[model samples]
Target: MRKVFITGTDTGVGKTLISSLLVKKFNAYYFKPIQTGSKEERDVNIVKNLTGLNGEYFLPEVYLLKEPLSPHLAAKRENKKIELKKIFCPQKEPLVVEGAGGVFVPLNENSFMLDLMQKFSLPVLVVARSTLGTINHTLLTLEALRQKKIDILGVILNGPLNLENKNAIEYYGKVKVLAEIPKLKTINSMGIEELLTNFNI
Candidate 1:
């Protein structure tokens, strides 16, 4: 089965949004290794509402820390450690694995989100903002993935429509801008479907 690990240049950059769209398009299983803002099931709930995809599959971490902080710090505050092995139990379908925060965000003392990506041995789909400063962030993220020898499926640029950065990303970054999603005041399943079609998901 084909699997793609979805991550972002930073938090709130639309990793979840893109992941949900991919899952809906490909009818793939979804997994969130470590979530910190809400209950583990809450991530699945939001994705379900956003994608309108039904299945008996959705896996999140067992320790759902309430703090909206990095996983490592949240786990520390809760007096727990995130076991890497827990993130990689075998699944039966094609998967879209969502990562928390940026590539280097710590999940524990020695492991970061990228480490989890490595653990899964899945190609990455980077979700980035379409606004200012995205070029630097996107390039750096791509470089990091290159350093790790991770296969990058490409990047999805999210936010208000902006052609300048889009061209710059395509030209300078030397990576395909797989899709560009317009800023949405509210999101629905059809909207998600539109974005997926753009990406050929």
Candidate 2:
């Protein structure tokens, strides 16, 4: 199966927005491996609403925890343990898997978001905020992926355009800046279209 694992430098850096855009553009299946706080918010629903895709294109999460904390903590609160074996990609092509929070986020005591991506053996598309603190966050993220010897597709700079941050990330991290998305006041198709104009999927 063909897949692209979407991760961010930090939580709320717009991973979902990029994932949703890719899903909409490719009409690909979306999967969130370990989802916490499903009761409060669901990434699947967000993708559905954003992409306007049918339910079949969105897969149910492997682990669904109640609390909004990290997967490890959230699973502990529910008295459940996450097994990496339980997290498997669908036997289908053109799937876009969205990771929970940043790359180092814990899926269990030993496993992290990076481990999951490694297991999938797919190219990673990192979403980074184009604001302050992004240089360290993004470069560190790139370094982590490099240490693991994983394939990096590219980085997507989200939010307002910052040339310095963009150039620095590309040069220092030795990774291409695939795209940049403008800060959105809305998230409908038209707004998404404008934000995506900087680059294509």
Candidate 3:
């Protein structure tokens, strides 16, 4: 088993859902270092509820900003700042960690999500949309990770299966199409288990 950092081509790209899948697949702990958004929509809670996992399987977020904005602006709104030094992984192995938005999302004035990804140095699994515009977004994300010399586990396509987009991403991005998760009528542990059988990490 290997620890993985989950990032997305953009916000609302189903990172949390994929994170829950990985956590369930590996029986691993889930950690979201910095979370921005209202308390009601916390990623940890969502993962726990979706997977029916307990608190032991989830780690507390370092920064839980109330505003649903970019991390830097959200922290500023609350009169605080995000520091990379304060974020660290628990001793648990094969943990699944997720990022806020895209790779370039700002964490602070000087540091972006890319900086934190580098700090962790975990192999990355990028979650991407399985629709139009994904080619550009997914390719750019892969390229950025490559330039940083980050080890990419590959990309996961979420939504209705689009063969063209999947082939384009695999060919142009030069990365494996690890899995294609369809839009489930009900997103729960059962759904995740079904998807697990469809693809291997």
Candidate 4:
């Protein structure tokens, strides 16, 4: 795929970790359009350290809100407005863009993260936590994407390996289980590179 838009079922659902993995495997340009919480550890920082790729590999975020909240609220907190026209996708191939949260996450008063994905027109690579309650979360995420008529490339299960959850997601969602990512005690090139075997890239 030329582009892979990484999104999660919820916050802390391994979007950045998976994004960094895809960046390493594909040697793709990593971009997180809007980022919240600039004072603490940002996703870009984590991705940079994990992927071990610097220089042109990372792209600057469009919106950098100071609060660690939803884009809409985060922008609101700063008395700023998130204009869709401001978020532009770089004309780079093999790009891997990560969303802040689930597909339905609010970006502005009327727009959501899904709206941004629609604008990018890239196949979604759903990153879900591999644990209890993932079935419902994955299915609901798939359903939302379906309703939006967005193409879902596949699902990536992160955390412990759970066969039952994986089977349920594939059978019920009718989407391919692209890969299952186990929790890594340490994020390094060697370990991260090994997990890439489960993916086609």
Q: Which of the numbered candidates is closest to the native, going by highest lDDT?
A: 3
Best by TM-score, which number?
A: 3
- Kindly give the stretch of ten consecutive residues in candidate 2 with the minimal lDDT sum: 192-201
Q: Could you give candidate 1's per-residue lDDT for residues 11-121 as a string of tens digits?
A: 989888888887787787888868897843457677888877775657655557778899999899889998787767346578888888899999898999888888888
lDDT, each prediction: 0.82, 0.89, 0.92, 0.89
Of the candidates numbered 1 and 4, which has the greater lDDT value? 4
lDDT over C-alpha atoms for residue 3 of model 4: 85
lDDT of 4 by residue, 1-201 (tens): 588899999999999888988888888889999999877767888888878887598999999888988889999999999888888888897899999989888988789999998888889999999999999999999999988899999999999999999999999999999988889987777777777865554
| TM-scores of the models, in the order given | 0.91, 0.96, 0.96, 0.95
Candidate 3's displacement at residue 133, Å, is 0.3
Error of 4 at 26 (Å): 1.1
lDDT of 3 by residue, 2-53 (tens): 6999999999999999999888888889999999996558999889987787
The residue-by-residue lDDT of candidate 2 on 1-201, one tens digit each, is 268999999999999999988988888999998899888999899889887889999899889888999999999999999888888988867999999999899978899989988998889999999999999999999999989988999999999989999999999999999888888898777766665565676
Model 4, residue 33: displacement in angstroms? 0.2
List clashing residue pairs in candidate 2.
none
Name the better of 2 and 3 by lDDT.
3
lDDT of 3 at 13: 98
How close to the true structure is residue 178 of candidate 2, measured as C-alpha lDDT?
A: 89
Q: What is the lDDT of residue 156 in candidate 4?
A: 91
